[model samples]
Target: MFYRIHQFWQAIHPIITEDELAWVISLLPAPSLALFQGQPLPEQRHALDVAQDLWSSGIRDSHLLIAALLHDCGKTRYPLQLWERVAIVLLQKAPRKIWHTLSRSSLPLAASLQAAEAHPLWGAEMASHLGLDPRIVELIREHHTPHSQEGYLLYQADNRH
Candidate 1:
């Protein structure tokens, strides 16, 4: 629980250094680098950390690294404020019917909620449109699914920080 709180705080105020940006740019193509830059600072930091974790774990595949770096790019479409993120977390525990109703409501929260729920698919579509490798697109689309070994690693890394 405390870990989650720490994450929430971090998400609201992400800190990225110049060296980190340089390192990330070194790993991606020009267009993909633009997409990475489009992400919120927090998401950017998270992606960098995940990719670094994968590298430290001896996973050297460029596709996986790129996937980790851009997996949450979909969230850029509907950026959420800190409170909205909290609400989305709480909303996940609500019944499906309630969730659907809330998601469809006229409230501004609905957009962020919808985005949070659909980011994987949206991110995958974006990646595909950008002409990323099919494997990278697959990883983005199924980042939360946790069926394959790579997916599990991504999921674990995401949760860790």
Candidate 2:
């Protein structure tokens, strides 16, 4: 996967610094485990479904497809189930209400959360450096926060599908 990403990275302009490579890589799904893993990651499946729906809607923008395919890529950086367990363990030492809030937070792993809002910037930089069209980077950056009618529609379809 890194090979593919490296190849793509080489084709684009230099936006992300060398120091940011590991940060960006940490956001991507484990390339090898992504396929034929014990179970398909829900986020990956959701992304694929979103991509298919977008494609079926006659949205020809490759940027949109790529964005939809990777919208939740950061989830891989965090393990929700593990955190849930940790939350449960911590709840034993805290109030029930506080434990409830923590459990319901649905927060990302520390590393993943650290990269949460940063994914867009990272993706934009990655796409720009990889020589992907600017629109593609924009789509990725805005996938979670659609700022227009078109973006809203895309988000709706992605969520609905």
Highest-scoring model, lDDT: 1
**lDDT by residue (tens digit), candidate 1, 1-161:** 88778778778788888998887988887789989999888889889988998889999988888999998999988787878978987777789898899889999888887888899999999999999989899988888786678888887887676
Quote model 1's TM-score. Answer: 0.86
Q: Enumerate residue pairs that collide in model 2.
A: 12-129, 12-130, 12-131, 13-129
lDDT values of the candidates? Answer: 0.86, 0.51
lDDT digits (tens) for residues 1-161 of candidate 2? 45434333432422434443343344333441232122224444455556667767897665566666665443444444534424433444677566455445666443433444365565556555555556655766676588866567566865464
Candidate 1 yields a Cα-based lDDT of 0.86
TM-score list, all predictions: 0.86, 0.47
Candidate 1: misplaced stretches above 4 Å? Answer: 93-101, 104-107
